[model samples]
Target: MTPSETKEHSPMQQQAQTFGYRLLKQDGAARLGEVVTPRGIVRTPAFMPVGTVATVKALTFDQVKQAGADIVLANTYHLMLRPGAERVARLGGLHNFMRWDGPILTDSGGFQVMSLSKIRKINEEGVRFASHIDGSRHLLTPERAVEIQCLLGSDIQMQLDECISLPAERKETERAMELSLRWAARAQRAFSDLAKPGQALFGIVQGGVDAELRQRSAEALVAMDLPGYAVGGLAVGEGQELMLRTLDGVLPHLPSHKPRYLMGVGTPSDLIKSVARGVDMFDCVMPTRNGRHGLAFTWNGKVNLRNARHADDPAPLDEQSSCPGARDYSRAYLHHLVRSGEYLGAMLLSWVNTTFYQELMAAMRLAIAEGRFNTWAEETLDRIERTN
Candidate 1:
């Protein structure tokens, strides 16, 4: 039977009848937990690779699973625009369409739509924007955002919120945050109206960079008692320091029992530091995107495979990696493949990079469970910075 149709929850699912988090362990502000879903349980400190167009660029869903991702993220805006949400639902939802039965989280598409400001107009109702695919006009209401995610059969759905660029005046930030709060209420009402089983909806905290504004945004969303909470509006040209500071300012206000997600955030170091500050789930396209650009993220640090210095280097990116590209293929060969623009280069590097990220999350999970996350992070960061 389909997950939604299951009359009986599994033993593990019984522990969490609906979608939720069970805190397993904690060290400092870092936490280790399990996100119990109908499809499976996602370990805490999870990093969801962005499969923005229903695919993770070059890699297949099997490769994504092999790389250790318990859950993958999809874009609501993109899917709603192309192929259409109704079309996906008719084909048996995103899980059947993508052939991935595991848990899936979908974004509200607010960020992507906001990026098309030149072609979009914003008001109290929602954003009316032009589609990039064919320049067709569309109105993205908060109610419609929840509707799309529901049609996609997303296990974890993000509520529609306004995301603003950094360096904005306090007045602008307050305006956006207040608007997001309104959207959160409308989105929640719409989500509850459907009341789909075995799924959860999350509210986003957005306020640009102001401390008071962020705190206000967090407090408002917290009042809603969302199933999860996401810290948005960072990684939008805001430096790492400010981002972490914002997390520090905002996270304390969110409930610890629920999962805390940092949206569209960043590199290996960024993950390390954010976890240190109490964030649990994260999603980003850095690894796959950079892999396609001829870059590799290793435990030792990032490797620029396109550089000529590696033309004669016989060493692989990492001899210990399970991924053949990092464990078996030599730097010289990888360099040549990248230089020649071979498809294998992108595939191999994408797999290798994604594997490394999962490895990092696994390592952090272990450390947090063992009460050694602080020391582990310190040593790991030192190693990454010192390595090439």
Candidate 2:
């Protein structure tokens, strides 16, 4: 039988049969589970590195896997703009085009269409906007977003839903939330019609910061019974406390049988907090972006590599780090590279930060399995905050 025909007996089925979260072990809400997909299985409490375009900026696919990423997120907005989804499809989809065989999750471009585009008009039908790259005009509706992800052959595709900014009036938030729900329904219908075996679609719940509205949105999406769910619109501009509270409000309403993803959030603290609140997956660019700026994440908080004190320090970034850049490179050498404006500086730091982020996720999973997540989290944060 072909791969699609055998998908039910494949690892993806094994994971799904055990529930979207195949609980290998659990420590409180923290869990170590496998998220089965047609491409491969991803470990829970996982951190997916952001590959905005086809590539993960400066790093090779092999290097990315070596850094311990089970999956990576690609932007539909960027890819559709440049290489065009059709070109990627002609080159054998994103996996072969990008030369990475692992599973990939593609965002619906809804967020970018609203935030990055120069001109945008949103209606029940879809969104019309000018491309940020060259001011090219394009229309992205729920159906179009689904179609683009299908062309890219993503293992997991997100529904195109409206994402509104926070701290807005009640009426505006409700209007945006209602629009997102309607778009989500259309996206789901489109996804179901086109979904091939081994591919899954995730519904997004959007309500800005309103708890009642968040619950309403979650209830509406859950009723459709998509493969998974994502909590969006929290990390846009809200403070950490509010973000966590919003998650707390919506997570309980999400179906437990499916995976829960928190979109575009945050610092290390945000990750820990959200995981404790029962988030299963996350994707962010902080690690790579911050790394490129000479910042490093260590067990002892974030360190700026450009500091003068590092000029004479002989210690590595972290002696116990499994990553070469973190364990083998000295503070003095890294500082010199940063000061000299060498490209290697950004590359090494990005690698280290990526490694660190993965390591942090692994540690959280372990702590959860050991039933010491709270203790571990507190201690970890204390250590990081002390020296930062």
Candidate 3:
């Protein structure tokens, strides 16, 4: 009958039962947990590096692992267009294709669909668009999205959702939210048709910035009884305070046993705040994107390698960092590489930024388990500010 009803006894959740999460500890609204996937187990409060198109930009799979990421995310849109999902599946699926043996999460190409608004049209069926890459036309339906992710063999797959841009009227937000619910049902049926036991399907909650709408979406998606849930549509220009507030509205309705993912979310500060608000997973492009522009994330804070003040600063970004790129390289040297537009600059900075993010997650996990997250977060934020 309904998506929620079918989800209870679906084949997807029946056999393997491998895709599961365990709550290890909790501190206030914050939680500590572990997600067991077919590939491996992802420790809770984890920050997954965005590996769009089957790779984290400027870094190899080994480097991704070295950066402390137990899992990474790939874009269904890009991979489907360039390499083709069928081709990837034929060549041993995403794990072997990307050469990353750990867990992988794939979106339903929904964000890219929204981003290509100029070239796309949405209907009850799906969205049709002209690819930004080669101007080729394509149609992405909920079933097709599920099929593509299934072909990619993602350990965790997101449902195809209609993500509305912010600053919209209540009616527009409601329309998009309702469409997403319908798509969720279609996605569930498609996912159930192909998903194995070890894999999972995650439904996204979308209602723009409207708190009431967010609650509605959360309740509807939660009714689906999916293995994981993601809070979507908030990071689209909503300020940090609103984002956290929106999370507060949705978190209560979500199943505590399931992992909560916040898509394309934010800066270091955003991650810390989201975790404090009970989010268990996050994926963002900030760390590497900022790194390529010569920004370095460190224990002390952010370092702008472009600043002339670092011309002769021989100090390492962080002497205590285990990453050689972050601990061994001098600031002056890094400044030179970045200033000169050298490829090495982007690579090294990406490595360093990734390392720092992982370190942040590790620190939070420890603090939450030890029951001092609030105190630790306050002191750490102050330290980062002072170091900056």
Worst 10 residues of 3 by lDDT: 1-10
**Which candidate do you rate higher for lDDT, 1 or 3?**
1
How many backbone clashes does every candidate have? 0, 2, 0
TM-score of 2: 0.94
Model 1 poorest ten-residue lDDT run: 1-10
Instruction: Report the CA-based lDDT of candidate 1 relative to the real structure.
Output: 0.88
lDDT per residue (tens digit) for residues 123-161 in model 2: 888999999999999999989999999999888899888
Give a tens-digit lDDT track for model 3, residues 235-341.
88979988988998899999999999999998888998899999999999988998899999887888999999999999998888857888899999999999999
Model 2: how far residue 171 lies from native, Å: 1.0
What is the lDDT for 55 in model 3? 83
- What is the full ranking by TM-score, best candidate first? 1, 3, 2
Q: lDDT of each prediction vs. the true structure?
A: 0.88, 0.84, 0.87
- Which of 2 and 3 is the better model by TM-score? 3
Best by TM-score: 1
Listed in order, each prediction's TM-score against the native is 0.95, 0.94, 0.95
